[model samples]
Target: MPGPDLKRILARATSDDDVALSETYVWDLASLFSYSPSASQAFALSFTRRFGRTKSWRVAVKCLHLLHRLLRTLPSDHPFHSHLLRSHANAIISLNPCHFRCTSDELTIFVRSYALFLDEALFCLQVTKDPSLPPPETFAKKVEEVDQAVELVSQLQGLLDRAMDCRPLATAGRSSIVRSAMKHIIRDSFMWYATLWPRLMLVLDNLFQMPHRLCIAGLDIYTSAAEQAGRLEEYYDWCKRMSLCGPYEYPLVEKIPQIQVRAMESLVENMWQLTDSSSSSSPVTFSSSPSTLTVSESGSSNCVETLKNAAINVEWEKFEEEEKPLIQFGQECADWEDLLEASVDCSWTWAPLIFDEPKERSQNNGDNGLRKHEANLQEYNPFLDHAHPHAM
Candidate 1:
């Protein structure tokens, strides 16, 4: 297709005498966009670059309107759509409102174009069932599309900075663009596309540090999530590491102590099961009082019959079962935190623990004259507090 009409029109439009009027060139360029899958950037670029340079504000408005009209016929799958849209936007925006004489109305062209592109990018994201699990090509394409929209939004943020500096009226639109772009960045990185914990942490780290108004809302939600999951302690620790540590408005409320206590109680209750099985195999030896019992080992016999203390008794096999999993989990965690309420038992910092029980004090045996056991809930737990830095 030799496009004789296009060539003839361009020849006339470019003639030295006709340089002042670009209206004919603008309308013809919009028409050129309708040419199907083979639309070339050269014509669209020429239209935007040439017509947008009109010295008259009214003529610039006309050129902007022409670009808008061209937007209507943009085929859904236009091969050059992004390039065309971006070029058109830059051309109008380069007419930077205040000093260069390009009016605020030209900005409307960019706003509309960007809104369309961003909306389409969001639509594509909706189809991706799992962003992390998407096929490689599909994933890359979707991410690239999102990145492009985010980049455009960044431009809007810069525009807002300028608008605030000189043109207050342009501030609202540019602020809106910044907010919209920030939302997309958050949604794509944390809400929809986040597949790994580190990535989610990264988003939180950025949000916690950003002074933008949007970040306040983001942090509010983030704090609520951490509170719900009982990881506020660890979460804020990372926040500090990223230099994004903010005032932790939420109080650290933990149900972990209660949960841990309940688990220990359950293990104690279940201890009888193992004891019952072991009783037949291992003979029990008793003394007048466990405190007076002495271990008289004649050889390296690996068996130690229970020397039951007058106050407390422990099932060794059952305690091992209950603590082993916690020990393994802690060792695997690689966490150096002094206190992680959620997984405190999984801390590997503790020394090799063989046995643990609360100590007891007998107060003259009272009137009964028999020994009594008083277990201190907090002051005398014998287990090593590997999870607490102060304990170490």
Candidate 2:
């Protein structure tokens, strides 16, 4: 139920000629910007207000189908052009106020078409990739790619901004539909960012200071939208789910601070274990300690390495597999679970002996006390206070 422009665009597009097809494609793409649920409701209201439901409802439904078909053809660089097609498709959802009569068949077609568009867009933005794309040629090339990726992301952000700024065409009863469309537009935009930013980080070699900025921008968009839309709980939950999977393996150590290193380490480790459980039947757990610890033998002192090596060396398939459980766990934990649950699972069989003791006590007791303390927190707390103020 768009204005005359949309109808004209569609009419010209569906004509039996190449010009119509190409025009249809571009028109469809442009129409994406206007096709929010809210906007549709507004359009429907405008139509109904001027021409009564009986006269205008069928035309509105027809417009929806034409828009859907047009959205089905957006191109992408990947083999699965369907991926790109979906992004625009999701934008064409119907808003509340029942644009036309609510027969089950019509509603089913509307929902199916809208859902298909969303799925296609989500897949294209998050899943479709050409393995054959040339790797970054040099550090500079990597940086440039990162910059380009950032620019593309910014363009996307601008589109959302415009969508939010537009006035809905309907003035009265269809407000909810207009709002729903706006929400859909914003949500899809954020989802696109979530899917693409991480991949861009992987492709870029040396981002210099870009990753930090990108992360901050992403976090800002997520936080702001969640807060404004009263979706903070859902947003946090989604973030937790996404982080558990550990999206990309850019050399983040150089970009993030040391204090944040442990947090990132836990996330990375959890992600790794989650992704590659077969590598070690026992889950990989992280300890809340620096890399080195102390030990004792024959009344002599020794140093032991407690930190696992901090490099990611996993295959992409394994990473993807592990990410699912973590994402699911995050969703489950988001509303009720403590934030720490999202951290690395630090429960290891041997960690108490190696890293959970005072250096002096470790030298004398051979880490026996540390092991005993882990089994009982009341004992561990008292022992830790007396033996390892530095460790605390």
TM-score each candidate.
0.25, 0.27
- Which pairs of residues clash in candidate 2, taking residues 3 or more apart in a chain or in different chains? 37-181, 38-177, 38-178, 42-170, 86-121, 87-121, 96-177, 274-322, 275-322
lDDT of 1 by residue, 97-215 (tens): 32324446544444333333332332232222333454235433533433333333333333322222221133422343323322222223222222323222333323212222323
Top of the candidates by lDDT: 2
Once fitted onto the true fold, the runs of candidate 1 whose alpha carbons sit more than 4 angstroms away are 1-39, 68-77, 82-99, 102-392
lDDT (CA) per prediction:
0.37, 0.38
Model 1: how far residue 163 lies from native, Å: 10
Ten-residue stretch with the least lDDT total in model 2: 295-304
Q: How well does candidate 1 match the true structure in TM-score terms?
A: 0.25
Model 1: per-residue Cα lDDT at residue 6: 53
Off by over 4 Å in 2: 1-58, 74-131, 151-215, 218-392
